[model samples]
Target: MSIPENARKYWRANLKYLAVLLLIWFAVSFGCGILFKDFLNRYSLGGFKLGFWFAQQGSIYVFVMLIFVYVWLMNRLDKKYGCNEPNSRKK
Candidate 1:
């Protein structure tokens, strides 16, 4: 069977969001934590080295936040595409 054009659009949008989020994740988790650690260490966050905090805690927090963001975005997208659950809660 052939996929509908709307389905293809939905998937394209989904992939765009996923790629952006993953890029953010990678930047925070690896860029600040390793590649730019020296530059980031020049600052402080709650008295902890910025780079260290990002490596140990900040990235984790960002990831959790991103999960929520994805949920919210996808929910909106589902609604826009008429694919949302009828009984689901709205944002």
Candidate 2:
């Protein structure tokens, strides 16, 4: 059983990116939202406690930003690996 070198590299890169992004997601969603809330609560954001904001709002914002970042990163990765989709245009 043998895998092509390019395929192996692509999968490795994909998984690496996946893991990093997921870790960040977990940290924001769980760590800030739950574990460090007390510490964060000591601070305030826009008249709201930071910890409460993170738990109720900031985590969601972070998640949405992460999604955009993931898309941008993956597009770059696709180009790097020469697996990008063909340009589709009528010219």
Candidate 3:
């Protein structure tokens, strides 16, 4: 079955956003925490090693932020694309 043009557009935009976000997530979580850990550890934030914090807590926080951002962004996209459902008003 062929996909609708509107759906294809939305899917393409979503895929683009997902790819960029995943790249950033990987860079921060694995690249900085594992690959460049030693250099990053030289900088401390509060009593935590920078790389350690990123590997442990920081990445989790970023993941949470990404969830919220994705939801907000997708909602906006839905409205923009006229894909949002109409609100029901109770009389």
Candidate 4:
């Protein structure tokens, strides 16, 4: 049996969300942590060099935040596509 069109659309939307979120993570984790490190070093964050902070701490923080963001987006997506768990909590 083949997948339904609504399922296909839902999957496509999910992938789009993943791609955007991952792209943002990569830009922060790699771009800020490495490529822009020199430029970022010109500033300070809590007495730490901005680039070093991003490389060592900021990326991790952003990744955690992204986890929550992904969950929130997926929740909305699930609701939109009528695919959410029947007992799932809403906020």
Superposed model 1: Cα runs more than 4 Å off: 86-91
TM-score of each: 0.91, 0.87, 0.85, 0.92
Q: Which portions of model 2 miss their true places by more than 4 Å?
A: 86-91
TM-score for predicted model 3 compared with the true structure: 0.85
Tens-place lDDT per residue, model 3, 1-91, is 9977887998888888788788888888898789988988999888998989888887888888888888887888878777777762223
Lowest summed lDDT across 10 adjacent residues in model 4 is found at 82-91
Q: Count clashing residue pairs in model 1.
A: 0
> What's the ranking of the predictions by TM-score, best on top?
4, 1, 2, 3
Preferred candidate (TM-score higher): 1 or 2: 1
User: Quick one: how many clashes does candidate 2 have?
Assistant: 0
**In candidate 1, which residue pairs clash?**
none
lDDT by residue for model 1 over 1-91, one digit each (tens)?
Answer: 9988888999999999999999999999999899999999999999999999999999999999999999999999999888898765435
**lDDT per residue (tens digit) for residues 18-88 in model 4:** 99999999999999999999999999999999999999999999999999999999999999988798865
